[model samples]
Target chain A: MGRTLAEKVWDAHVVRQGEGEPDLLYIDLHLLHEVTSPQAFDGLRLSGRPVRRTDLTLATEDHNVPTTPGPITDPISLTQVHTLRRNCEEFGIRLYPMGDAEQGIVHVVGPQLGLTQPGMTVVCGDSHTSTHGAFGALAFGIGTSEVEHVLATQTLPLKPFRTMAITVDGELADGVSSKDIVLAVIAKIGTGGGQGYVLEFRGSAIRALSMEGRMTVCNMSIEAGARAGMIAPDETTFAYLEGRDHAPRGEDWDAAVASWRELHTDEDAEFDAEVVIDASELTPFVTWGTNPGQGAPLSHSVPDPATMDDTERQSAERALEYMGLVAGTPLRRIAIDTVFVGSCTNGRIEDLRAAAAVVKGRRVADGVRMLVVPGSARVRLQAEAEGLDTVFTEAGAEWRLPGCSMCLAMNPDKLAPGERSASTSNRNFEGRQGKGGRTHLVSPLVAAATAVRGTLSSPSDLEPLEPLVPAADLAHQEA
Target chain B: MDAFTTHTGTGVPLRRSNVDTDQIIPAEYLKRVTKSGFEDGLFAAWRKDETFILNDPTYAAGSILVAGPDFGTGSSREHAVWALMNYGFRVVVSSRFADIFRGNSGKAGLLTAQCSQDDVELLWKLLENEPGTSVTVDLVSRTITAGDVVAAFDVDEYTRWRLLEGLDDISLTLRHEPDITAYEQLRPAWKPVTG
Candidate 1:
């Protein structure tokens, strides 16, 4: 029997495997942020233990840092960020402070710096750490206790995960994107569908996506209850890593690609479970309820709870009440108060350009407020260099600094109570943005179009504004 | 970590599915550096409603949470575990649990008992009908017992052993340091280092 991609990675990283004991897997990279690392560092201090591999561990200030600028104003938020800085300095780990050009969401920083590579094991204290799995890495989220274990020993004793193959075939339509495809998959599988498995997104459509699109898809694996998500490395993956800051150079790069080429699943390998999705069948998808799985096509109407089973009906009832929606309403007509276009999921340069293309000569709707936050400082810089920032700002949107803003709302950027938004970030869980904040997860294109219409929409729904003809030009033409 | 052979407590039947960590403890409470003292943030939003279950006197002292399927589904925040433990919960009974939450619960010495959907439904009914009903989660026998209804539960063997013996993971992994060092030497030079 041949080995699956996940099995091969797991086997290669195993340091110790014994009878009735979980396998101790060595970690290649450990990314940290202020929100979850303080307690782990404190645990290390109390145990009188030194970090085992500071070379493999990295820390950054993202969750609590203000995206708008100035010092971190919230006392508690400041202390968390400061504590991370002190701990990283004391323990000799690389620290990327708030103002550092490299500082951003840990997930984004890892890939942007070329630190994330194929056939590696990445661990972070944040769920979105699965974002790094885009490069064929076996990455997953860890709790603070596991974080401490990795800090002290550089290894985690983890039980084997079951493998799942989520095969998405066929080409997506013109206006749809990776975000829509993933939303459709979650809706088909439910949030708990992928529990206890590491999903391998395979087939034609997945292979057709760019690196950014693949990252967006893999980043939401957790929302579907998967421990991690992976796509086998290919020419596209090699191209993205070619000249990155930390990518191997000269002869080392040639050797690395040779090994990466072997990282795919063998032809005869088997998965514990399998799900197949037709990419061509998907359209602009959006979450209509508190959970990611409660989604519908943009052309469809809000589903009636009466048509669902007992448990689902109950969940729908609660979701409907919290979302302030009525059944039978067209999803495109659902009004939104805000539009957020950034996160580790969709805050890359490509995402910004996609939004910018929609808002180039357009203005935000009268009552809508839009925010375009880049995923990293590098991404922000790239956007500005391409004039994407001018396009967004000229459209009446706020183009701000890089951080995990509004997505989790740990910093000052948050939604007011009862406020609703069309967000490009993952996770539509209750109160995920802020207390009483309703979120409808969408693609960058959908987020931009929604901002211009003040309702849930797609680029196709936007009608070109009547081209302005000056009165003087009209008078001259009349003469 | 305390050993957990068995626990007996009143049940708080949370009838919600997909109860994500955000609802367990919102992001605002996550700003604290310390892990403890999250009881006030457990279901902070739901607690605002005067008619919420935790607000009712019947289940105020409950130390066991009998929730709907797919409990603890989103976010890897261990703060959810701390919040539940701080609020005095020792066991969470559900038909299904997200992988990370189950792992976090095990590390924090909170028992997560998985029963069949029918059994969970029965437990919820019994707890709700008799508001203050005592539920005993026996790790020794892998069973949950409540008022004329007894059902088997499932937990992994290694986790079960660790919970029964109150073992620390870091200490255990340290015993195999030689193996880790040997593995490190054989690692490819092309692998990137943070520094």
Candidate 2:
């Protein structure tokens, strides 16, 4: 049988494979962040081993750094940030410190800087490392020990993963996005459905999305219990990487594209499992329960436990209680205390533009708190250049710098107990955002609309944002 | 990482599905600069109830965790494994485990053994019915057993060997450095690399 995309990439990177032994695969890139790198650095130090390839290792101060333009306030968070800086310097590994233009969530920074590329083996200590798989890389999160392992030796011992094909056909409806599509996929396949599998998202819908959108889809692969998710790199992927900061230039670029073109699954490639989703049937998806998989289209009401199967009914009931929702509550009627439009999942420039388009003429709801955080300093600067910051500020959203603010809440940006939020971040596990906080995952468009309505709203619920009017023309029109 | 040969200890049944790494060791506790001493942070939030399985005096000394399906479902924090190991858990028994969590457990010399749901439930029942039920896990035989409850388990041969030999992955991979260097040389010159 022809090998799948993952198998191709996996086969290429294997240094050695024994009959009963796990494969020893070479790692091309290692992305590190504050929270998970300290112990790894310590492990390398205690063993007196220098990083095998500092040129291939990159570190960034994220996870615990404040999004606000100031020094880190939390002592614990501050210590972690400092440790990473010291470690990076000691190890001669390049670091994108907070406030640096390149500094952002590692997932966002890697692709933007062209550090992640097609047909590479990428490993990070954060679960969202799967985000890099959008570029057709065999990327997955490794634990701190594995982080040390990769740093001390540019190879990781691995067990081969089963390949799964998640095929979605047809075009998405208006307002529906990659986030909605991924949520729908998770809902179809429960959280544990992708266990021991590397999902190769294929078909028309996967091929049609922008590079950013594809990243959003693969970013949540872990939420479905899959360690990694990927989309075969194509023309769009090549276009996105063409002139990136670290991307190859001129003749090298052509050669790179030529090589990347061959990364697709072969005509006769075999997948261990397959799932099909209809793109046209998808709607503005939202999670009514605590977990990412506990989601349905906004048009659908919170599922009634009585109508669900026995095991599902039990989980639904518990989810409902934790989410502070009635079994039959209308998902659209659920009000949110906050609307956060940023995270590695949707904090890219495209996502910011989408949110800006929705909130151009609308203000945040009476009691809702809206926060618009860019994924990186580069993104923040770009947003400012395009006046996205002004649009968000005028919409009553607090515009802030980016470093994984509120996604995992290791920083100061966190929800208080009992607060509910419509978030663009991945994961809604209990206490994920905060101790007793609740989060509903949504697309940037939905986050903007929800901020305007103070409820789980889609673009249809608000006054349509007007077409681009010059700042000079807007004041004249007011007269 | 210590070699995990054969461990015979009391098992504590934590019957919760999708028990993620966030709950195992919260993100707040992840700020520590070192990996050691995470025992205090294990199940930090859940310990508030004073009734959580690990907190009960009857299960205080338990070294085995018998959990429901999909255990360790979120995050790649190996600190979860460190915390579990620090709290004296030799093995985590579940019907299923998230790939990364199981891998982390193996890397840390903490065993993650898989069994059928029926077998898992039987183990849970044994642990719950007989508090401090001593279940013997024999890695050599790949079986877990307690009074009236016995079941075979599965652990990949490579991971089993690593745990038994206390082999460090770095040392193992370094043995094939020349192979990786050769593969690197064959790569297209156009391929972008990090700096």
Candidate 3:
């Protein structure tokens, strides 16, 4: 059998083969955020080592940064943000501070700036670092010590990960998004299903996705307990990277595409494990339980505990109790107090546009608060330029600045105690949105519909909004 | 990071599976910039209930955590390890650990000793039955002991050696700088430099 795409990337990045030890893996990019880097920088300080490759390291303020787009007011959050800038300055690392045109979630900024590329090993202190793998890079989350390790030396000691081919074939139904496909996959695989595996998402449905949709799928690989998720680079990948600020240019662009074109898995490649799902068969999926794996179709009732396996039954029971729901409850009857459409998972321009498409010329339900946060400042600018912000705000939503808001609840944008939300973010773990808060993970379209009806609803549950104005009209509005 | 040759401390039994780093040190507490004082944040939410092992007076002085499998399951924050260490834990005795958590523990000099479930249950029982009795974890011998129960534990030998010698991985990796430079030289110029 031939080598898998992951194996090929791993082979190329090996700097030193540790015969009796873990191989030394060269890191091509190191993305950092406020939450995990402060301590790692301190580790460098005590060790008396200068940053080995400052050029490869890029820092941004995401977690704990307020989404309000003003001077950070919270003392603790302010300190965290400022400390990152201070550390970046002291260590000679590049930083995209809040309010900077380039500032955004590290994952969002990396790709938007054309910094993420094929066949590179990307490491970040945030789990969503797997988002970079959408470009065919081998990227995964790292701990603070590893952050320091990468800082002092642009390499990490690593053991090989097994490969799993998640082949999603067929066409997605109208209105179903990449988020739903991933949720459906999680529901089948369970929370820890992909443990010790690097998932290679293949087949036609994956290939058909835009770069944004692919990033959404790869972003949540950690939710399935996979170290990383990747899709082989193709025309779509090359088109997405071409002409961007940090992307290859001129003859270099031609040479880069030549190398990236060779990144696909061989026809005879043997996967360690394989799972197959038909994209057309999936419905708009959402998680009723605390974990992302505890998901069901929007049309179905919450799962009966008796329906689950023995081990899963216990967790399902606890999840139901925490979510304040009973078995057999109709998932559509689950009311939400808030709706959040942001995060590295679903805060890109495409996600905002998708949600905006749902909320256009509509009004949010009474007693419901909806927040539409852009994944990055640039995304916000793009959304505003295209009148997505107007569509959202006219529908009673708060169009806020870019940051990881209400996703991990590291910032002030959080669900109050006992408040439930329909969220587009990955991970619905208990207290993920806030203390005593309940989260239902859904796609951007579902999130918008939930905000409109104040219940866990999908687009089909509401009167469809008018289709977007013609291109000429949209352009005229832009002027 | 300290070298973990041997540690003898009372074990605290936390009989919970999939205790994630979010629970270990909630995202709320992660705003703190310092790493050394996270003991206050370790299991901040769980400890509020008097029933948790950390809140139990018997394990108040415990320095070893004997918990159920999948301990430290979520997130890549090293604060979980820092909090455990600051709270006096020098070793974690679990059936298994999340990959990142185990890696973080090794680099932080907090030993993670993998024991079988049956063995872990017996240790939990022993600790609950004999309050304040210490458990001895020997990295050199790769064994954990309590009273009459002795069990062989396992960790990656390379990680074990690094922990035993208190190696700073940054320095260890820098030894390969020449190889890294060679690869960089050969890297196609069209491949955009991350900087």
For TM-score, the strongest prediction is 1
Off by over 4 Å in 3: A306-310, A465-479, B129-133
Q: Give the alpha carbon lDDT tens digit for every residue of A362-478 in model 2.
A: 889999999998999899999999999999999889999887888986888898988999999998887888888898999999999999999999998887655787899989989
How many residue pairs clash in all the candidates, one count each?
0, 0, 0
lDDT at A79 for candidate 3?
Answer: 91
- In terms of DockQ, the best-performing candidate is 1
Candidate 2 Cα deviation (angstroms), residue A26? 1.2
Native interface contact recovery, model 3: 0.62
Kindly report which residue pairs in candidate 2 clash with one another: none
The local distance difference test score of each candidate is 0.93, 0.89, 0.88
Q: Give model 2's DockQ, 2 decimals.
A: 0.77
Q: Where does the lowest 10-residue lDDT sum fall in candidate 3 chain B? A: B186-195
TM-score of chain B of 2: 0.97
Q: Give the Å shift of residue A399 in candidate 3.
A: 0.2
